[model samples]
Target: GIKISDSHDEPELEFFDRVPTVWDDTKVIHGEVGKYITVARRTGSAWFIGTITNDEERKLNIPLDFLTEGQSYLAHIYYDDPNVPTRTKVGIKNIPVTNKSTLEAVLPASGGQAVWLEAQKKFVHPGILHTQADIKRTHKLIDNKTEPAYGSFLLLKEHKCSQPDYRMEGPFRIISRDGEYRHTKSKMEADFSAVYQNALMWTLTGNKAHARKSLEILTAYADSLTMIPETNDAPLLVGLEGLKIIYALEILKYTYPGIKDEDLVPVNRMFTEIFMPVMENFYAARPYTNGNWGSIVTKTYMAAGIYFNNRAMYNKGMDFYLHGHDNGSILHYISGETGQIQESGRDQSHCMLGIGAMATLCEIAWKQGDDLYSALSNRLMKGYEYVAQYNLGYDVLFSVWEDVTGKYCDWKTISDKARGNYMPVFEIAYNHYVRRQGLQMPYTLQVLEKIRPEGFDRDQPAFGSLLFND
Candidate 1:
């Protein structure tokens, strides 16, 4: 028999309804195309979930209150994306999983996953709070009794570019030789920034070996500067320059803390000679007439330039994002001599990029005790409220202006768009800002808290508004 249960004559499960908590089993184990999965979900009265795969390993933070109030319950998980059906889709097997549960989940190569929760009678507290300050903090935070958004962004920990030939791999695959032609060539057009971003996460976590490997590929790209083409149509597949280069330089400085000023001169030379001119032309020519294209690239470069204290380049780059267009102006890529301004994901994403970059710059400035930088930072933070309106769903905010209708919708309706889509990152970031002033309560609660018409928790409200100001 190909597969069977271990029994004397018939198939039977060895551990029926036995909840297994494996917090130690953290790393991903399997990698299969469209069908690999592994997760370590927390099991306690309050649920915690962690999911990852061979392709990408991401962290998740879930609050304990996503469960039934004052009741100990169990979770029945069915974790596989049904849309991606294959012969090896994990079969559904009902098991006794509970809130005080930290379950391990493993996913395959190219496939995705899903996790479900159902109430079962089982109560166990996970000793989450202890000290007086901790208790006070918790009480103050939840006095309004709102739930937190349980989402994660694939943040980079650290990346080092010492050796000159390390390249990273991509997640997608082609079925045949001809099919490969239509797809982006992973090697030829690899996105170095994304690789750096992912590597940064490793570095932040003190994974020195992983950080070195990621940086190796980046150094290789910098060494072969002449070979890498100047202009590439592939948006995701371009070499880092200007502000990105400055970011890389900052990393190098961090890695080699005791290096002399003369040693830094050579690294600075590469930016001034090779990258600076390109930035000047790119900013001056301004090829992208409409859309967020120019702003996104410009802001990335400007952020880096600002870090190096390149006043002229930094100002121009900042201007492109802050004042190039009026608020709510959209970028339109139409058939014309100039790019038209139409609401698009390109602009929305760039808008976030602009605001986020400014925030980081302002923080750096404030730390250095520079009043000018502090002023600029404050201005950017105030301006960000206008763009924060665009965060749409869980991990997938609406990039197109049309999706939001250029005005606030009802909170329930906003919750509808935020349901189960891959937009959790934006929600978390936007909430952080809004929550500071105690205004994140209603909007966040609208999504995490289920609405009931007649005391039935099962009846969730659909199409609710997320526009509660306070």
Candidate 2:
């Protein structure tokens, strides 16, 4: 007979779900030839034990000596029960345990016991952009009528009603050289903006209508669109355009229970079959083509990996983010000495785009326990400061290389349009550096204040005030 039950209701299965990886301190505590075996492993201050027996039944003594010295834990034990009159026959009990405690497990013939020992304390939720706790905290803040959070919530409520309507179906294709292609691309961008804004609004407001609308838009495209047509600017389309939708899906899937598992299947398949391959190849093959390409694409890859819960994909994206192939990595674009970005020679628009993308990436990474913001002795902050100084109309002394030769040449001057359209890029950086880290970001703060109540617009970088200000 096989043990059959909902995986969600099983202790061992739940333990595996929570602790995806086991610790290196795993060891075989006791074993007997053809009789029984017992093994224990630790993960994130918790210990899990599994014991198995042959046809012969045996009683085993389990010790809690491996626990942290000063901490206590609640040990959840699951074992086979012959009297339960079910094939699964699993029964569970909770026992308080300490480093000095010992437990006895009674194993039946062809049966085993599983123990999950967890510390009774607050634990941090894991993720890149938003954690479970962060979502709960956002809810609490809104409920408490907090200032910026409530303001952002009210703004999203108004924005959802007044936002432009988007089509359900799309012949979504990329033909960068054609005017029609750009129009379609812009339309798709507008659609994603609606999707993400609505999904996030649903999270804040608990309105089922908003979630349903977001799902309606998502399912329409996922069911109809097979692939995004390739073009000269495939990387940009996949990275910038496709990634925004991915972000919406991430928020929806995690925040709302109304989203069915079946709904996600097709969407995940679309990502794996179409977007994943393109992103993998783009980052590996075209890392040096343009600085913005790597920044945007790496952000997409990292966020997609987190959405799908794929560690390999996440690590691959992180690797490309830190170390690019030729001249496309963050380190490659950011100057270690002056901290000016590589695209600064081109224009401030692309410079802000690149900086904003990298800043968002660092924000997500910081949430996931990686400090790419301060990597390379605060290289990203330096890049932000350099760009902010110039964009704020401050004169900056820097040299630009026109070609591979070390020849210094004057490129396009920073235009009024570039300086005026400051994307909501400073909120995340200012919040992290100034409010959280207690570090000074004078220029970043000035720009952030200038763009107070930084609302959304039809642009590559949207949802800044909604995400970061709160």
Candidate 3:
């Protein structure tokens, strides 16, 4: 019989949920008499593979030649992971595979690996981050005011009734020398924050008042902010705050039938007419400021694209996210799987900011049936681990990385400013990799442990414990 219980937590139990009790056929994929053996078994519509090794550890490339050619499978993998804090020391995760796919399994001394490949199926209804199911689950957990979530709910409680910050003051001709137009920008952030907090309250609690207040804030902005001139900071302004407005409106539009298409007339007009020109212009300019700049722009545009059913906009965001020339693209941002991000040598705050910002985009993309989180062999996961390990007071290998602007840290080391003070960034990443994807995120979990019951963030995503803890 399998071991009864362990402290491995989420990944441990999730492995049990999919282990097949019976199979149709079995075949040896590879073997070395007393040293190790790898076997594959087929069930009704799925395939499972198990491999074990003697006391000596080994690295093996297991070719999935047995799978039907030209067909796709979602492989749930369980393997030995010393970092997994459990008696069994097993790790688990999911990855897409085909007959031509090859899995690289790293086995420890007397350790093994397992994989369960099943045919692809339809996914859940795509929403920003909190889908209908996600919202329902959050509400169910809130009924008891669950520990960490309870903590987060209490925090949200303080701001759920935030008065809408519509810039009723005239002379709204905003100007910024170098993103320093704080007065109007602060109001913009506050107004969007009100919408988000109120929408979140309505989601967790069955309070129509909260919903109305959220919509009221959005409608107010629609009425007042007519023209968004391409002030120097217009792109930066929308890139940063548009996500909040889009996320809030998504909740309201899905939950409240009161929102008519015409109600969005002014909002859509403003975004398309003036907002889009500058945002698109920013990417076209290829300023290559930092990973966060392009990343935030990609996120805002993607959110708007999916929300408005604008495929061109969605394509643009996805294009930039995957292969933009800027530092924010997946390839450019991650720096060749060392998990050293594009902004690693810059400073800890900016490094974590870029990480969390990209994590936000990946989360959104994941819900929509794309797997950017696990793309490039879990490159984002590696980045999370690298950042967490450094911030948790450990030394990591560093290499000279230069940006498009030919800039490098002359000190030849990662910046130490605000090192240990972690942002509420890792919780979403931890939940996605460990809980949803069944992969071990040891360092990310550590960060979350240090800062559990994650607080809220005004611009970037926060409230991780409440929003993502499963």
Candidate 4:
């Protein structure tokens, strides 16, 4: 008896080389006897057929009835060829085939043949979009005559009307002030926020002027800006500021066709060389602070990954989010037990900031085929409810970490700053949970109703109501 593995020069390898195998679609078409086996598989629009015989050399007629009727295909056959001088003796032939065609297969002892059938058609490149299709759907909704969508579009139009004539000046850099960078950080943030506003205006209104102005700002910064100095707020600067700039660029690229390749080359380099490295290094050096830093840093990394189309960098961002530094992992920050965020003990301002950034990251990931919104079994919603309840002036009992005991031993209480300054973060979450998914978020709904037509404000990653409300 001849062993199938004993054949040193197997011609069957040519089949796999010529035809891509889709394991998911593989089926054993004929294998009643152990002496012979036949298999068929479909990949994309093509099909692969393979047949093998044990010991006995055999002749078999194979039918092509499995193919789609009325369609023509090209069949590439790889058959054993003992007459060939090569060790792996295989002969190839290309023949026209159809559903009505049948072909004879002759096999040597312990030999096999492979056939690849492909349809004749034009090829097209499947380019990746910067944002998800859902985002595109939302953009269409903006034009619909509805409550939130209409109001959101009008708010963006108002923002466009408020902008001045475009100006470009940079190679901009600022160092930490008195061991802090809050003032300089705010300045950088506002600049990028303007870019997002302009890009968004172009997207909604189809106004060429808005597109041109946005490109002007982006080109200026991408050309002149070399580095952002590492300051006390470097993490926030790189993550938060970089995220907003990425949003602006994504919108600009999506809306405008006239942006030159030269303009974007420098901008891409800036992200890869400067902003990305800063974010990665910061997260590596200081992992998990049980606060907003991890989320902010991850948000930047994810944005950079999407902008550059780098899967490794994108996965790195997801890793940081799923398993962050001690006390800082998104899972740990939002208590599984009580559904409250870790930073609620510190203040409402920071807590909201963290929640806002996390939601933005989730939105981005959701667009890219990741369900991060439900990663921790809806822990994000719990965190939102935990904050929204207090911000809406409702008292809820919960536990928080006490610095003295180093454990969650104190009763939760609203801070003096609680609900005082509303951040434009509610729209994104509200749209996803309440509007899109139809999940009830009463407190969150109340917050959204109060802040309808959300506009850009300092420190908010997304344009909020303007971009996400619908």
Which predicted model would earn the best lDDT? 3
TM-score of 4: 0.67
Clashing pairs in 3: 92-438
Global lDDT for candidate 4? 0.67
Give per-model TM-scores: 0.39, 0.68, 0.70, 0.67
Q: Point out where model 4 deviates above 4 Å.
A: 1-142, 160-164, 167-171, 175-183, 288-290, 402-414
In the range 368-397, model 2's lDDT, one tens digit per residue, is: 676677666677788888888888888776
What's the residue-level lDDT of 177 in candidate 1?
A: 14
Best-first order by TM-score: 3, 2, 4, 1
lDDT, candidate 3, 1-470, per-residue tens? 65555332333444455667887988899989999999999887788888999999899989998888777787778886776444666665666789999998888888888888877544333388778988888887788888888787777777533433323232244423244455576556666777777778777786777777777766666666655556666766777767877877788777876678677676667667656777878877944477777888888888887778665566567657764666887767775537897787878887888888888988888777777786556778899999999999989888868675455435377878889888888888888888888999888888888888888777576888888877
Model 3 superposed RMSD (Cα): 11.4
Listed per model in order, the count of residue pairs whose N, CA or C atoms clash below 3 Å is: 63, 0, 1, 3
Among all candidates shown, the one with the greatest TM-score? 3
- Residue 26 in candidate 4 has what lDDT? 71
The predicted structure with the larger TM-score, 2 or 3, is 3
For model 1, how many clashes?
63
- For model 1, what is the error of residue 158's alpha carbon versus the real structure, in angstroms, after optimal superposition? 13
Q: For candidate 4, lDDT tens digit of each residue in 66-161?
A: 888887776777788876433666766567779899977898999988888877432111111234443565567775656666676666566532
| Model 3 lDDT, residue 390, Cα | 92
> How far in Å is the alpha carbon of 427 misplaced in model 2?
0.6
